[model samples]
Target: MRNASDLPPEAAEASASGVERRARWLLVLLAGLLVASAAYLLYARGVFEPTQTLVLVADDAEGVSVGMDLTFSGFPIGRVRRIELGGDGYARILVDVARRDAHWLRESSVFTMERGLVGGTRLRAYTGVLEGPLLPDGAQRQVLRGDALADLPRMVNAARELLEQLKAMTDPDAPLNASLREVRQLLQKANGRDGVLGVLMGNEADRTRVTAALDDVRRLLQRLQGVADRADALVQRTDQRVFGAQGLADDVQASAREARDLLVGLRATLQRVDGVLAEVHGIAVNTRSATQDLDALRVEVEATLRRVDGMILDIQRRWPFSRDAEVKLP
Candidate 1:
């Protein structure tokens, strides 16, 4: 456990050299760790991965800068690599999208650069259809710029114009004011005389119209009362005629009884007539059977001829008329 001062100069020098070597090794290790950390950070940021280039043209690049992220659904899919002035005088923004994340972008994808009043600008991508065709490498596309405070001046101008219009409408000499004054006058009249009825009939000169209408209503009520009284009397008379002891109902019942008796008599008479008709039909049949004497009938017909000849002779004697039916000519 001797002190280093008691050691030989060679051994002391060798110990010093070994200490120096160790210190140098520690410093080199620290440098290597720093470099490794830096490389890991770059790799996490996707610096080492191969990327596709996209060109975005815009009228303005107010808040856009290099190294800004182009995000889709809040995920960093691409980055703004550079911004340059194009030959057409527009700002041409260059974006670098990594190969893995670039699949989210399609041919129909839309890009926007939005600047807000409260925050820095954001570059965003929107893909309408994930199944659409892929965006080609080095595709030149347009970036739509949107500003949250862009329409503020126009809106203020519109508000000022509307205020002027409202002021004009409220002016003393405006027709709208005249109409409002007339309405106020009408509201005042609504509280007077016949109340709102007078207002409905019209102004001061037409106040009597409401009074006349009231009089007509009174007359109509009186007439209706008279009509009701008359109708009540008529109903009483009708009740007496229909239901009283000496009423038309009693007379109708008596007539109905007489008619029933007459109908019974008529039916009995028709029965008797029907019996007589039956007897006549029987007699006709008997007579037809008894008159089956054809030879006797011919003999009677001869006898009738002789009688008729005698009658003719008597008629000739009595009348002194011509028996000859022949005519003589000169």
Candidate 2:
């Protein structure tokens, strides 16, 4: 703690020089550290990195400000650098996207500014197709704004309406309550002695009558069913007698075969008769030739006999009862 005046002149000068040199060195070190820190901060902020400019136009930029992140798929790829009002009274937000993240943006990319109920406003980019054409530098695009608070009134109104409806439904005189009461009454009626039948008939006496009528109908149906069963049995017996192994169809077929055989035999007999008639005609011709005066009479008699034979043949062919009809020639 000696005073500077109590020191020797030379010693004091040397001590002061040393102190000046140390102070200068300390100042230099501090200046270097400050420069390094500033450079690190600039690098971290991506100030020197190459980036592309994107301008987003919006109707309102209430919650959007400079340094706000623009996210893609929840990752920050760009940051808002400036916000200005346009001539059309719209907000123009300028964003600087790093060159590496610029590839994620395409011509069809969509940008949105969303203000939620519980969080700060978010600026988001959506790229549906990565293979689409690249978005050029300084591209100006419209941003869709979504504000959750904008629909608050409508949602409140809807909720109020729902509450009112719930209150009305809870009222004793409400239609829903009335329907519930009717259903409860119906359930009580169903639990009565006649059960659902009493509920349907509306009265105990009517329910009893309906039950009796139902029993009567059931008995009548059973009787009719029994009668139908008997009729079916009779019909089955008749069917067995008429259309079983020795059926009427088989008998008729046998009779038809026998009739066909008779017809064949009759045809053969008719052929033989035709031959005998031919022989008779030859004999008549010979007789007529031998007796010239009786020729005309023989011819007339022969014609009449031919007509009678034809009539007998026709009757035999037409008559179903005369199956054994035979023509005997003299």
Q: 1-330, model 1: which lDDT tens digit per residue?
A: 998999999999999999999999999999999999999999998899999999999999878889999999999999899999999999999999999988999999999999887999999999999999999899999998888889889989999999999999999999999999999998998877668877786775587776788899999999999999999999999999988878999999999999999999999999999999999999989888767786689899999999977777766667645677433334
TM-score of 1: 0.61
How well is each residue in 1-330 modelled by candidate 2, as lDDT tens digits?
999999999999999999999999999999999999999999999999999999999999999989999999999999999999999999999999999999999999999999999989999999999999999999999999899999999999999999999999999899999999999999998997779998898887898899999999999999999999999999999898788899887898899999999999999999999999999999998797668777878999999999998998987888788658865657
- Candidate closest to the true structure, highest TM-score: 2
Candidate achieving the largest lDDT:
2
What TM-score, to 2 decimals, does candidate 2 have? 0.65
- The true-structure Cα RMSD of candidate 1 reads 13.7
Candidate 1: where is the Cα deviation over 4 Å? 1-12, 169-179, 214-330
Residue 15 in model 2: lDDT: 93
Worst 10 residues of 1 by lDDT: 321-330
Per-candidate TM vs. native? 0.61, 0.65
